[model samples]
Target: MNINSWNFKKDILILQKELFDSIAPQTAENRTVANSLLLFLKYSAKCLFLKWLCQTVENLK
Candidate 1:
């Protein structure tokens, strides 16, 4: 709910959008590679967000 948390979420969203945009225009030959890279980014982002959420919750206690 705070400014820092808001900024963190915004940054994550921007990074995700940029990643998706970068991979969206690849050739068919590179589709497999792009798919894997996108999957990796998605999982990494989820992990990062979860970690941040945990820390934020801990700070509130």
Candidate 2:
């Protein structure tokens, strides 16, 4: 919830965007698999971030 942690989260989001942008799939099948993997990773990251944020909020109190 602090400025430092907010900046850190922003940096992480930038990194994640760069990472996802760097992935290039050539064939249709590869593209499908890549999309699926990307979706799964995004979902997982959201879940983890929410969990961490909840814990941080609890600790702050």
Candidate 3:
């Protein structure tokens, strides 16, 4: 990819890492909430990506 795309991806990775690092420290009550939301987001993203990939593959076929 071009420098611009690389820069954008780098920024997103940095942000994601920063967010995880910041959320790692959970007191007591916010622990479950934090983990649940994180997992939900992760799974939702995976499902959406897989759906998109399937569509792309079907189109190619």
User: By lDDT, who's the top model here?
Assistant: 1
* Candidates 1 and 2 compared by lDDT, better number: 1
Runs off by more than 4 Å, candidate 3: 1-27
lDDT against the true structure, per candidate, is 0.93, 0.90, 0.91
Runs off by more than 4 Å, candidate 1: 1-29
Please give the range of 10 consecutive residues that has the lowest summed lDDT in model 1: 20-29
Model 2 CA lDDT for position 1: 97
User: Per-residue alpha-carbon lDDT of model 3 for 9-39, expressed as tens digits?
Assistant: 9999999999888877654449888889999
**Candidate 2 per-residue C-alpha lDDT over 1-61 given as tens digits, one digit per residue, 9 for 90 to 100:** 9999999999999999887766643356698999999999999999999999999999999
The number of clashing residue pairs in each candidate reads 0, 0, 0
Global Cα lDDT for candidate 1: 0.93
Model 3 TM-score, all chains together: 0.52
The stretch of ten residues in a row with the least summed lDDT in candidate 3 is 20-29
Model 2 residue 60 lDDT score: 100
TM-score of each: 0.51, 0.51, 0.52
